[model samples]
Target chain A: MTDQRDDKEFAAFLAGESELADRYQALGSEQPPVELDEHILAAARDAAKVHRLEFGPPGGWLKPVALAATVLLSFSLVMKIGVDSPVRYEQVVTVSKESDSTLEGQSEPVFYEQLARSLPQRTLEMKNMREEQQSEQVIEEVTVTGRSRSIELKDAPMAVSILGSAEQSIDQDAALLIVAEYVAMLKTKSDSGRFRLQEMERSNESTAKEPALTASSPVASKKDWESIDKLQTEDDSESMLREIVRLYTSGSNNEAGTRLDEFLAHYPDHPVSVKLRRRGY
Target chain B: MLPGMANRPDDKVLMVRYRDGEVQAFEVLYARHKGPLYRYFLRRGLGTEPAAELAQEVWMKIIRTKDRYEPSAKFTTYMYRLAHNCLIDLSRRSAYKITQQVIGDDIDVAGLPATATANPEAEAIYNESVEQFRSALANLPDEQREAFILKQESGLSLADIAHVTGVSTETAKSRLRYAFSKLRQQLIRNRDKA
Candidate 1:
């Protein structure tokens, strides 16, 4: 019952019809000192200045220029990389020819040796015949012979008998085995040939090739052979391997050391490995 | 400024003008509500310096954040909410000490001389009674004091009070009830003394 009375009194007091309400109203009427407005406006202006300074000039253009430069630089770098890469067209063709010759040579070593020996003579004869035929007629013919096989070559004519040896000579089951072995051998020969060709192409294309030969050339008068010799001796993979072994033994695995480890793992029997092992490894 | 013109612009129009760099629109808003915002801080027992500082900060905040302002509610509601936040922020920063005795003592009873209809002796008695009642109001909890002040000073409806206080209407009403009951008890004690 008392709680009910308290609740009623509280409700009536909240109505604000009492003396307390008037005093609150009077308290609300108190005025603050007048300088606050100036201080706050000054702060706001400073903030506005900061906003303008940070975001105003060139805000519109910076993004597009940055974006355009990024795109242009990326495109230029890609084009430069593409252009600077050594072309391997001749290398690829050499590898393909070596692989094909290896395949044909594998089936009959004696025949291939005989053929290889006879090629220079045959080429000379063909050259002479072509020289004679060129003056008289547009048509030309030539003959080629192997140990047990012969072929007649004519202009624009393809000989299919060279490819028919395995099919004709071997039993059907044995022929498949020969074909598989031939393919595996061809694949191995092609891979090694490709690597060798690529190395040759890179060496031919780079000025880094044949420093010793260039050093001896009379035309290369201005060349500093001593510095060249020093550089070559320093850059010799053997020296690099020795430096790597020294670092590893000293427990100083810097970038060169890391690169040496990678090099060793990648090409363990590389020519420098012998020197590397002799030095420390 | 024309009377009430500062208060009369549609909040949306004022906001749009303010966005377009019409500083006058913001000045008008400041003028329209400066008295109410000042009163809000003053009634909460904040000193004159802090109250004025908080009021100015509230306006500055409105100016700084004007670009983000949307008039989804009445401008007056938004203004009071900003003022409330500034006051709370000021209190937090200063950790201002608010005491019931200080609140009660700060009220100037001399300013409100008793009505002439009462005998001089009786007026004196009434004035003392009013002072005592003010003291009791100071003793009320901060939320109750704020709810009571918003109701009396702004004439805000319960919903408006709730919106300003960030409380439900029921909670606001409850606070008001507690504030009034405490004040009524003090006034009743004063009436007995008279």
Candidate 2:
């Protein structure tokens, strides 16, 4: 019960009603020297204004420039990726013949790669054609005779016409595939032997009855040599097999590797496996 | 919990303005509390030079950390914490030369000599007891003196005292109790001689 009295007295002292509170209150407060206040306050004011630009926002004009550069980079990337859909020859839209005139005037390696990836079949064939011809040979433009006038197929729908012997070298097989599609298109339109497919140096005197190319008819220009090479890969299915091998070996897909094992059991003599054996796989 | 300064914008408002880069806002805050904060360090046993140095340092620290300061407590509570930390750092830097006793949490304020207000001689004793109490204020243990001074200077409640001194509210109340008890006894003990 006496402890309660101390609690009341202590509370009174803390509340400044007691004599002890009167004594502490009697002492006046101390102030920091004026110079210290000026020094500290001056520093506080200075801090608001003085600092490196990077610690805050960049200058006014820089943000737009950085934004523009970022946008330009993104656009270039998206254009380079092309479409995601499965590619087909039917999907090949023909560009205007007049477009060829402009394409033939410029020479840049970038244009060659753009034209190559634009058509999947031609990209593969173009790579092959580049390897075979060693890329020094000049490309010949094919001419198609329309009913009203002789229109060169040089600017035909496929990417080949886009090259048009511009100093930019491209895949020969790309050019041939374009020619085949153009030939197919022309054969239906011109019954008169006005349509002729041949090397630029070949005679124009050749007649319209030149065998209307059978749907499956081989391209006559490289029929014998290219046909034999195509037949060999077709018989072995080496291209498909090589692609599966590439996917498995690169560890890009576990499913591909599992399939490769199943494939090796049935076809252990597959060319890539045989090749790996020679390399001490 | 702050009262009676209703028209004056609080430290939090000034702090927010300072954060938004108005240097004048910081000047207002500095002017409002500099005396109390400086006196806190001074009375806490830092000599005048070290007290001034630490006061400058506390302002600089507030400026340096302004952007990260959230108004999580009363501005007085926050500033006093900086003062508390600065005192601790001074104590540590001086290798614990602060020989003040550890003020304990014994809140048992029982059976002490009763406060005397009866004698007319108490009036004559008051002036001298005031001087004695001021001397005793300097001599009180660190925690007791800190609690007393913070209460007298900032008008912080025991809860705010707990926050400023980094102790529980109960401990803060205990320290304040012990502080007033010592001051009362000191005043009366010196009253007779005076």
Candidate 3:
């Protein structure tokens, strides 16, 4: 209780209600050494200067941006030196020897050969079309055909159309002569294989050679047809012989029988005719 | 600290100037408060070297954190609070129990006995009793001594003291009352004996 009373009196003394407050206040706080004050104040001034540099309008943004750019440049250099670049253009050219057609009847080996032979002409037509579109300083034109990815960059602009706009057709007369010769050689293999002593009377066979060989006969030139019909090779004769045998095997007996007679008249001494005779062709 | 010195900028105004990119303003503020801050740590019984280092650290913190300064409280309250926290951090770092041992623990605190003889050469024993009074002040408990020193040094009100010390206003008042009761008794007894 006495302590509580003394507490009030002293509180009053601290509040300057008594003369004792002056004497207490007269007991002054100690002073720090002059060196210490200078050191601390110098630090404060330096810090204030740093703050101004960091947040002052232009300097603030510029330092950070330059720092960021430098960091990005460093990272880019590290990546360039340390990591290997991959080979970007890897090419595997696969020649497809197998036929893709699904047709089941009447599509003979000769027909497929003809289709394969037309491929170069078809590519020439597409190249012609690309040339027609641009006449500039064409640095390079590389066309990869037959379904393989190639390792060429199309550095120049090209309008490459792979569809049916290309009208690349072989001469109709040569195509027909090829078919006709094939038919005759095939007939010789199946017919009685001796030279027919009588010539194929041209007057008798004139009707058989009428507009010729399809629902839509080829629009071939007369001179071209004459030239192609007059030309022949032994390998072509063998292939043609195979084609005639196919015709007979397919049961076109009347046509095959007459064509056999014509083939014997044309190539009477073809050595394989003797074999046909033995087979009672 | 004087009420009549209104012509001079207050601590808060100088802090605002420093916050607004003025270095001279902070220098003015540091000059005003360095002595009181140094004495606050010195009286906590930290040796002169440690006390000087701690005081320097407190001012550094104020400078470093000037951008975050707000005028919600008096600058003296904020400054002493930083000082108080610096001392607490030092106490913990030193791993000393009874971290803040009041002012003279490092220097004047030689564990003097409760009696003393007056010097015959002195005209009055006022000077001698003052020293005794300081010893008695140092002998107060940590919180009570802190309250008395803050009141004497910073002249903060009870509410501001409470805010600075993270205590209630009533707790601050009670601490101040206890400290005053103790220090007053010691000083009065010493003066009577002299």
Candidate 4:
């Protein structure tokens, strides 16, 4: 309790209620030398200046903004690659080849030859239409057996339309004709094959002069009728032979039998006729 | 006496403004606390030169670490804590011995300027009582003397004294009480002898 009383008295003395407070206030007053204050204040100014430079206005927020911009730019580049460049011209060509079963196993030159031959006769009308709309540069050159020719079918932009028009009229013989043309085009690699192509053309010409092969005939298909009409008016022996082959392969057995008999009566010595006889046609 | 005590800003606010490169704020703070801080070291057994050095060291530390200063406690408490640590560090170094002699023994008491009193004899007696108080204050233990000085000089409360001295409020109060009792006893003995 005495200690507590002393504590209260000391608290009162600290509050300046005692004479000791007055005496203590009269104690010596000393100040730091002016030189020391200047030295320390100069040091303070230097440190504050350094700190101002270190955390300058741009230093704090610019780093994150630049980082975010870089990330956005990279993301946009990846999106452009993924979204815009999806299909290539080369891939379209591949898909076109894969869809056609007959074009399988053919070399590129042979494939072009077959593509040209298998195109429908209506493609001729489209060729006339295309010639009006496009420049001659639209034609692409193809090389077969060391002989390069500019065929209308190559690089033709209307290829899908050509196939679409041929869907109803193309018979088995037209398809086989495409294969045969591919084989003949590939065979032209040798001199013997060239001579054979020339001989076939000559025999076709000779058969055109024969009256029996020129007899009037009925055709099953409108396309075959067009070819026959063309043969009658123009006397194209190649067209006649193609029509006969079309009738034979189109399941018209009786019409093909009559056309074959009449053709063989005039051209018994024809190489194609001899080949047909050997094949039991 | 230090200047610019009229309507001063908060000490922590002054420190923060100084941290933001306003040197004028620091000048105000230095002017406000320089005398009390110097006297604090002077009365704690340091010679005038060493006490001045310690006072400057404490301000320099305050300036250096201004960026890290949080206003959690009173700025006076923070400043005194730094002063306290510097004294402890000086004690550890033992480069300057802490003496137990009366603070008045280092100076000529007659050379001190007389207090402004109309009665010269009363002023003389007042000077003697003041000198005796200083001697008694120096006679107290270092912790008690430091507590008393912090309370009287910096106007720190008992809790602030505890915070600055790393003691509990009760312990700070006890030290101040013992210091007051000792000084009062010494003054009474001197009065009786005279």
CA displacement after TM-score superposition, residue A277 of candidate 2 (Å): 59
Off by over 4 Å in 4: A1-7, A56-281, B1-6, B105-113, B118-120
Q: How much does candidate 4 score in TM-score?
A: 0.54
Residue-by-residue lDDT tens digits, candidate 4, A48-167? 777667654334555787899999999999988765442211101222434344544333325343444444442453466544233322233333332233333322423323223323
Best by TM-score: 4
Can you give the TM-score per candidate against the true fold? 0.42, 0.51, 0.48, 0.54
Better of 2 and 3 by lDDT: 2
What's the lDDT for candidate 4? 0.62
Alpha carbon lDDT of residue A129, candidate 4?
A: 50
Off by over 4 Å in 3: A1-8, A16-28, A57-281, B1-4, B98-124
Residue B7 displacement (Å), model 4: 4.0
lDDT of 3 by residue, A3-116 (tens): 687767876766756544444444455566679888887887777778778776334577898899999999999887544432132223332334323422222222323332
Q: Candidate 4 lDDT, tens digit per residue, B21-113?
A: 677788888888988998888888887788888998898889888878888889899999999999999988986656668365556354355
Per-chain TM-score of candidate 4, chain B? 0.88
TM-score of 2: 0.51
lDDT of 3 at A9: 86
Rank by lDDT, highest first. Answer: 4, 2, 3, 1
Q: Mind giving the per-residue lDDT tens digits that candidate 1 earns over A186-213?
A: 2122322111223323332443522232
Fraction of true contacts retained by every candidate, in order, equals 0.32, 0.55, 0.52, 0.55
Q: Name the TM-score of candidate 1.
A: 0.42
lDDT of 2 at A21: 54
Docking class of 1: incorrect
Better of 1 and 3 by DockQ: 3
